[model samples]
Target: MTTNNNTLLCWHSKRAGVEVLVEAIKCLKNRRVLINRAIVLVQTDTDSSLYLNHEFGDIGLRFITASLENPANHNEIYQRLETSVLPELKDVANLHINVSPGTPAMHAVWLILHARGHFPSGTKLWSSQFNPDTKRTSISSVDFNVNTYLAEISAISNSEGSYALYGVDPKSAARREALATLKEFAQVPKAPLLVLGERGTGKTRLIESVVGIVKQKKVVTLACGGLDSQVVDSMLFGHVKGAFTGAETQRSGLLREAEGKVLFLDEIQDLPTSVQRKLVRVLQDNHHYYRSVGSDKEETSDFELVCASNKTIKELATTLDADFFDRISMLTITIPPLRICREDLLDDWQKIWGEVNVNPSLPKHAPTSRQLNKLLESSSLAGNLRDLKKLAFITCAYMNSYSPTEALSKAICSLQAFDDIEENEGTKFSFGDLSNTTKDELDKLFKYELARAAKRQFGTWSNAGKNLQVDQKTLQKYMKNDS
Candidate 1:
């Protein structure tokens, strides 16, 4: 078949099958191709077996194999195609298309195509759409337009899917508003973002979701907890070959790799004073210097910075270098804890449990509204979403053997045991049985618990203030009045 070099027929693996086929058709339409040859690239001989043995096996197309199981051969295959086969193609006008689904192989094909300079500048790429039904299946193409494809991409990018590893229910209107605000900031133009939340409220998942949106962008995630100044410096800035005792070969630092993408530093509060100073410089100037063994070269890299911490920047501002604190504080969003968003448990539970295989035949013992309310009311989720999800899964298993009421009663009794620990651990103030306390006393107790909860959640006055739905100064007054 005659085809233009402008239209490349790139077929990704048929794992996501018809969804990818539909996407490929959409891309073909956008490229304005009248007729094109399809090149189906299979990751394995087994994968190729499926298509070769399929009913529609007579489609006029070439098949290429690019499996990663054997690295040496894959490299040879890549070179041969890049240097030989691709150059020898009869129709350079045939648009290079990638119809791979699911596997990293699809992305690899796209990168290879880009490296070969086959497509014109600003060529939009479409990813294979996910099929929730059928296990390990294939698909056929559907008619799609460019605008429709773009809309699908946008929707997929924003919506929650199986990729959301961990999540919590947003119980209150205020908490939901806070989540919306965080999502908004994630979509904002490349700028430093600070995520302020409690330890277990799924701050990491929020960041991962943002990373998913900017899939093309490089992501460098750093966990700053328990690292001292020198370790922090070595990891972030990198060291020269022989720069330190363990240094062997010259390594590219995360900052360099994160260029034009995201550098997520988790537990930002743990960053040492000296390294914080260097981070500030990088954020402001978008460049840094690295000294290697027997060589000194200044490297320049630009990246969007996203920071997360259980502590508030304000509390750590005095302890951290002032310049670093000021630079990152410009953009901050607080993530609310599970206790505040108790109402969201059922929905979150359904989304989570639906994806994983959890003994489908076990029994239909889903939590009732009354049961959910009782679960929320009786227990304090000290670990927030992380704790809640774990508890839910446990409750699911626990309920299979026992009745819902019996399972729930056992769970509540176990949780109440922790109250004894809380009492003996310290005189930590709690909201405590507001049912019996007077309104005035309850108000006083609520303020006390809120402050304490904030302190536990964020580890700093300023961040806890943000979670409390108040400004820093107002939080200070509340703290003082309680004292």
Candidate 2:
């Protein structure tokens, strides 16, 4: 849909400054930007927005306002924006969300919109930047070059299917692809789905979202870890009253409960061989051959099966029956770890940290791109998405207690130094000036850390070497020498 008019949506935060909004519009105009629709979300107060509305009107940009009570509430903002914009996204030529004026949380929600495919394709993002050195405010378009991310926009619903990508770096191309695949499967749920990934790589989130997206009425999620074979059997296929030593009462099985709905088995690899065989029959034959403990009556239940494991389908094939592997390989979606795909993290979380506002020092000033990137690149964040989020909050906590006045730039520098030392020494180290730290020593330490990380991530040295394309022997030699 081509409109002579463009749309600009913005968030009005507590720190909304009239000058910032004015200069943003002026910059938009100076750049010959034509805008006819402007929707501003107001949360803090209306005084600045009154002037913002007037400025937008003066430029012939028809401005509208939505209210947000808490800018830091990511979920609320996400739902509100998604619900408000879906109907009109097609009609808008260029959807521009001004990032210059809202809480970081609000901005993060905006980024979520982009990450989640809520923004219509071809949308333009406008942002206001502050250059501390020059002490100037400037309006500009952010490089929202995520067209590849929008490849499956046609199959997309305005739901949170892409939520697993929430706050994730857009540069995480592989993860985005996995999200799209999951969404596609949810839309037309077919054969059994096998989600494969590293631990904490979000396999569980994908299955849960699938159930949500499909709107399954009756759902049964079973954790297949440390489960006794008999206990799992009793849990999956309800035991009769006094069915076993612990079965004091009759109960229905999860399979029976989830009939015609969804049955998500997290950590499916933990399923015992006998249990796995029974599950295979349910999927392959449309019938389950199972009896409750101390009961001969076999029961059956048909359900939409979604299984997750922190291992590859190929690796799982060795442990799982070949027939089961053949049966479930129909729809296997794998998620890559965060380290491999970390492009957009710096941009996404800088806004989130800004929104949190708990870091009083952060509210007074925005961090330079360099500071944000340094945090994103820190070796300390090896725990994937989960760890990064924790590190961000932890860093905020540290800022509040130890260095409330610390500029984000300086804080990031210290964090980098801390991680650097820890990484090199293979031990916990405190932050301090490493003035006399020699390049040779630092090099040795980095090599040791890299080798350790490589082994941890890739498992065997040979495997790591294959990925790194260095001979295993040579790689080990460098690591052993620590040079």
TM-score top scorer: 2
10 residues in a row with least lDDT, candidate 2: 151-160
C-alpha positional error of residue 82 in candidate 1 after TM-score superposition, expressed in Å = 50
Model 1 bad stretches (over 4 Å): 1-171, 211-218, 287-295, 352-366, 377-380, 396-400, 428-483
TM-score of each: 0.54, 0.55
Q: TM-score of predicted model 2?
A: 0.55
lDDT of 2 by residue, 1-483 (tens): 233566676765445455565666666767777666556555434543465444345344333445556657887677666545444454465677787676777777666566546566667777888788998778877775543333233223222223323432244677667776776775555467778888766567556644445544445799999998888888887878887787778988888888777788888778888877766766666564556667787776766777888877778989887777777767878877665555645534543344344544444223345556645543435545555455455556656555543545455565556555656676433235668877886666566666666765564566678888877786676578544
Candidate 1: tens digits of C-alpha lDDT, residues 84-136? 44433422343444434534543564455444333333333444344557432
Q: Pick the candidate with the highest lDDT.
A: 2
Candidate 2 deviant stretches above 4 angstroms: 1-169, 187-190, 214-219, 287-289, 347-372, 378-381, 402-483
